[model samples]
Target: MHELKISIITVCYNAESTIERCIQSVINQYYSNIEYIIIDGGSSDATTGIIDRYKGQIQRVVSEPDKGMYDAMNKGIAMATGQVVGMLNADDVFTDNSVAGTIAAAFAENGNDILYADLNYLKPNGNVLRKWRSGQYRTGMFNKGWMPPHPTFYCKRSLYDRFGIYSLDFGTAADYELMLRFIHVKKASVFYLARVVVNMNTGGVSNNSYLGRIKVLFLDLKAMYKHDVQLPPIALLYKRLSKIRQFF
Candidate 1:
């Protein structure tokens, strides 16, 4: 059971400022069988340089231009050779080193197809801006604006084989669309790990500005429509409202 191979992928494009910490967190994991793969989007900055410094520890490194983060994620998925797969973004860090092993044990023991947990949204100075507690997942939760923190979500590689990888159609909300498709649409099995597993940086593309939020809403509505989601306007409202709890 301890021998289950888990693939961890990190996608970056000119993320030199924070990529090193992200890489360090993955390499520091005590999990014996982590296949660490880095997908670089032909960064013109020193991002590739920092990655190069860890060449011996990293399993696979692909430096080239890609469509976007989702496209890069698909490339990493294709390159993964593990029984379970998860992603850690360039600007994100695991809450602790044990996170990888904890995830592996959960999969190796419980036999869940999808697993996710809590997260902390951190400001630039490393202050906690919000605490994302993904307490539980139930049918119809998505309509009420509920979903797992994607950074901590891990699943069997076979799930992607069955359902499909991230879709580019959703734009910045592809992660949201993918979750809606897999858990809600296909009804895959999931487990909640309870513990906080990731510390994500604030100010992602979607919430970066008012205009950005509007664009994401348009894309999200389109995704909800494709999945036959009910009361999308209300769902979107619920989704935004739910985030308020994170700041408390």
Candidate 2:
């Protein structure tokens, strides 16, 4: 069987502590056809040095000052030469090498343009904090306050070429806005795999503080309004409670 090449990008800034594990996860993938790119937003720490250690394995490594995370990601998207592109944070990793292969198989089976899977949240000490089960993507799911866990999602390069880059205006919800713009506004076709593909460390910037969650909710509301999409207030209540269930 011909290998399906997937371009995986990781954006980082002062992530020396977790960058190594993330790079290794992609470099050591059993799937040989991968274009791995890492973009460092002028890290003051040892993050660039860590990325250099694996220079031989990476397809492209860009280290420079950028406007923000999304800016760095746009560079990665431009440099990628693979058919499929997946973004994995510096603190997240694929569950195993077969994960990419499995995603490609689904694409081949149905020719869907976008693919997504479930994810788990881990603590700093590598303990499981919660399991984030991102259910299948169906029409009206967004109206029900449903979204694909961004970290575990992958898209064909063509999708980005058509829809464009993430809006730098949205801080944490840039991924959310991009999803809505593509899936809701443009009506892109998608597929969901009911499997955990990635493990992301908790305490990320978006949910590290009470204020952050409040800000996220505000941005989420703004994102929906821009697309003329409305989710019942009760749906947001249910989503919050469902997230709480993951911890137990």
Candidate 3:
């Protein structure tokens, strides 16, 4: 069997303090056939210098001005040349060195178009803040406000070519919209690995402020309606309520 090539993209802006951990996690992956790409939003910080330090290890680095995180991710996706593509944010790290290897094995055995696992949110002191357990996916789960963690999501490159990339208009909720479009609308085959794949540090844009959460809520509703989801109000409610369990 031919070895599957996996592309992991990390998108960032002004992430000088935390970028190295993210890079190191990918570099330390046990899987050898991995392509690592970093997309910087023209950060006016030590981020560029930090990225330069790992130039030899990274396959490609694009440092330029982008509209936002989602735009940077789109740029990274376009540059990817691997069969499977996954995104890891600047503040996220793989749980262990075997993440890529485990993902590759699942893809090889299941032949699923999309693969996702669970994740952990860590505090600044490296303590677990929340445990996001994305259970197995089933048909109609999207309507029930179920979504896999974005950092743990790995999809075949062809799925992006078919269903399209993230939408900028959704703001912080673009990832939710893309998942709903692909899993719910396009009916892509998905497999869930019941293990933690990534550990994300606290303080994401979506949950950073009350205003940000409101924007995310409205954008999420828009995404569901745009994708023809039934009873979006109920789904939105369930989505908001679902996060409460992650805290405990």
lDDT per residue for candidate 3 within 144-181, as digits (tens), equals 99899999999999999999999998999999999999
As for candidate 1, its clashing pairs are: none
| lDDT (Cα, tens digit) per residue for candidate 2, span 116-164 | 8899999878888899888767787777777788997788899998998
Q: Sorted by lDDT, highest first, which candidate order results?
A: 3, 1, 2
Q: For every model shown, what is its TM-score relative to the native structure?
A: 0.98, 0.95, 0.98
Q: Candidate 1: lDDT over CA atoms?
A: 0.92
- The lDDT per prediction is 0.92, 0.86, 0.94
Displacement of residue 141 (Cα, Å) in model 1 is: 0.7
Give candidate 2 misplaced runs (Cα > 4 Å): 231-235
Error of 2 at 191 (Å): 1.0
How accurate locally is residue 111 in candidate 2, as Cα lDDT from 0 to 100?
86
What is the full ranking by TM-score, best candidate first? Answer: 3, 1, 2
Between prediction 2 and prediction 3, the one with superior TM-score is 3
Query: What TM value does model 2 have?
Result: 0.95
